[model samples]
Target chain A: MNLDLRLDTSGDFYARKFQPTKREDTLILNMGPQHPSTHGVLRIILEIDGEYILRAEPVLGYIHRMHEKMAEVMSYPQYLPNPARTDYLHGLAWNWAHVAAVERLMGLEVPERAEYIRVITCELNRITSHLLWWGAYLLDLGAFTPIMYAFDDRERIQDILQRITGSRLTYCYYRFGGVSNDIDDRFIEETRKQCSRMKPRFKMFKDLVTDNFILRKRVEEIGEIPADTCRKYGATGPVLRGSGVPYDVRRAEPYSVYDRFDFNIPSYDTCDAMGRYLVRMDEMQESIKIIEQALDTLPEGDYIMPKAPKKPKPPAGDVYFALEGARGKIGFHLVSDGDKSPYRLKLRAPGFSNLSLFSEVSEGVLIADAVSILGSLDLVIP
Target chain B: MSEENAKPEKAPDKEKEVKKKEEPQVPKYTGYDYDCFLAPQELLKAVTKLDHADFFLEDVSCVDMQEGFQVVYHFDRFSQPGRVVLRVMISRENPEIPSIYDIFPGAAWHERECFDFFGVRFTGHPNLIPLLLDPEHQGPPPLLKEETALKDLNQLYPDRVHTPVSPDSEEFVKEINNCSNQKSRNQS
Candidate 1:
């Protein structure tokens, strides 16, 4: 029962792959497909010389459910609930992107009311996403109380969303032509109360967290990524906005009723962890503004289109539809051959692009600051 | 198209010399920057051109069509936002295309993901390994179709115009040189 054989065999696959690269002074660290700060099933392989990181490579595919394959196999309507699973926090935006892609291909006309409903509900979901990122990111940097404050507001918003969406996290409220249910007066009233309620909370957040000296020191100038680096890696959403190029798909490639709404795309040229942090905080307020404007001009019409195809067979062609999700630009590339099932369905997750830039930015940084930078990316590792 | 749309190619970031609007039959995909089919040899050239024009690679997607693998590279610009979809067809026998990772470092993972699902080899890719697929898992690529399930390119892209492109010209030669000289092709 000597321990030599067992210890040698017990090293996992990543550990085995990393062994050949080991040098005299440098250390290789495998940081979680399970570590709490990772936010999801993502593992980063780090080559470090003492505390400073020499090189870092994020190895993905841990929770690879093969969602793209599922899209090809499932019928048009049967694939509705699956997209939400990719980015659970901003579920509605993914839902809308998928539905909108199919709608564009099939030429289904969505009612004006349905478009407004999508706008209102999607903004509420965006707030929940940013709030979670805010708390979890702060928690990663060694703060705990902020998460409680975040979840407190997050739960109230989820309650309002769950009333119509019928689920708390992974939502499937959107259909091909329109939404599953229409927004009632109670829903609008509750949302208005919640929106007004969140304004003061954001102010409280600024005083309690943003303005704190220690937190500012942790995030302020750490991991500065210039605008040039952002373009090369194709990083989008707040990560791109934080670098000072105002490219929001809602504004850039205006899809749905987003064109009609008036809301600023918040960006900061500081290009550090604090820049990304500030961007999300301001974006949540902007989401509230969009939701309010949408509610004010909510039209009276059918919730779902009358002639929306139950089993859609789009004419032979393909389309690429993108929308502004909370994380970034969520794109759907669908190819059809006039079939009930899609020939090819490629999902362009924003997290994928945002995460790609990590290896380049993480070099020459302290291990702890690397964690702050990763957290600021707000990755939900789809 | 209006005067505004007509001058997209004449914009400072773009070159008016090689606007290859040769395939008049190709229908623009409404909102996109228009589609172009290129030879595998020309794939790297086109990518380099786009990279020099400040267009960033969005994603590298592969579709298993009848003719071969349709390797679609999507790119967009910050200064002028529009999707430039470059579709290159590879033979079914050997699904290989030159990697754009040297031009766009972000394409590394995407190329691996494409390879893992479609068995499409990205030549010159630094570490071409399975991305989403587990290494221990034993089976053919999940997305590859059997012979019976395969559909022809014409059926998949009914609106596609496939006029044969002319041979390599001096204009393209200078375009490739400009991209290579200006941006240092990424090593990893």
Candidate 2:
């Protein structure tokens, strides 16, 4: 097998070395830092001999921002903006996780209308995140046009989301107990219109990318992480679903008014990157179904009811809260010593687990095939 | 529970306290077994129980207390709502803890950044390298020190001081200064 291995010496980089007595005759090569396959900034130092080979070690912390430590200093309200930075592609979803966490701690109830609005916006954000992944993953496979086509529709959703949230990336919209502000009638109408428009795009996505001969050849049986291993690694979101695990935070955990809405947690038994790609694409369609349901059943009430404290102080207890973020289960564990600032805050990011499987799946695959596998994983950020 | 334990034996009260603690331990969702939250304070011991585990070391920053530093360890379980947190208090003289990277292997960078910003040292970290800060800076002990606001951060970051000198003009001035110094030396 032909391998396009490029050595990056710009930084102090190292790979896992094996001794003759320990493990003999294994060739290793670096995969990314700038490799187009690694979705965002990630460098996986792989140890392989020829096409069929060995161990893979992932070097991380290139994108580490001490988000937890930073939360300790910032007030409960002040720390709202930073969660968006963790996974910027799905910034809205991260924001919702933090807000949901704080709301649960303070014992604040989100109104029916607010819950509907939250579900609608979150579902829209989910579809948009998935749409970008669809485009970017194809680009990783060396197909260029689909990215442009996917982005064109994704921007329409961005425009709608941006009006209420402000700023394209790193949205701080969902506040404690409710949203920062209510979406106007125009926002609601446009969202309903967007859902109708997205259904046909899903069919088109299936026709264009899913059924393509080249795409199938590249993804069919490549980069497979078995269901047992996926469970062992604590994989969530599409990564888990691709392994035929029917565990979704929305369905299983039931955050917000998700239990009220009807949707299926789609899974595939294939357990490859292609399975992951297909599952996410199908999830976007499911998200559209959810948004349509939410729009029709949106209740009539005040968006921001006054249950939340103006100067909130969470009691001295531990609370674990999570939401079905675009990437997966984005959760926060807040330990409050009855202070305005959280005593300790831990964020369980999906990309961290999803990306961790790279070393396992990328072993033995060719350089190009490795990129395809990484692309199929659809890691947003770690 | 500690309060009741301190008091003389009260069987009923002790049982109630144990029940209160166990309620939160139960999985928030039905039909799912989330028994991972019941582990003791040793963080690494809890992580090693599961195979192929991915430790998401979210953040490691210290809090400034009037007396000493309170080191917080936030543990998030991927299974369910049992996100466990463990904390250790360290003195102002020396703040240290055994690194979790041996178990997780991915926490090396998170621990280093924690050391960089807060000066909370991870004792067994393989590479305690500095990240996202100047290598040579005569600043306070750590960026998050109590004296930060009072001190001028720019003075510590002298590389921030610049005049944007033009290369062409700088060379021209160098030649002129060399000629003038030659003339003065010859005359002397």
Q: Choose the strongest candidate by lDDT.
A: 1
Q: How well is candidate 1 docked (DockQ)?
A: 0.27
Clashing pairs in 1: none
10 residues in a row with least lDDT, candidate 1 chain A: A13-22
**Which 10-residue span in candidate 2 chain A carries the lowest summed lDDT?**
A13-22
* TM-score versus the correct structure, for each prediction: 0.90, 0.72
Per-residue lDDT of model 1, residues A1-382, tens digit only: 6565544543565555553234678877878889888988899988888899988888888888899999989998999999999999999999999999888776677899999999999999999999999999999999999999999999999999999999999999999899899889999999999999999989999999999999999999999999988888889999999999988988877777887988998899999999999999999999999999998999999999997888887766788888889888888999887679999999999999899899999989999999999999999986
Q: Calculate the i-RMS of every candidate, to one decimal place.
A: 6.0, 17.9
User: For model 2, what TM-score is found for chain B?
Assistant: 0.48
Q: Score the docking of each candidate (DockQ).
A: 0.27, 0.02
Candidate 1 ranges with C-alpha deviation above 4 Å? A1-6, A9-23, B1-30, B164-188
Error of 1 at A116 (Å): 0.6
Candidate 2 docking classification: incorrect
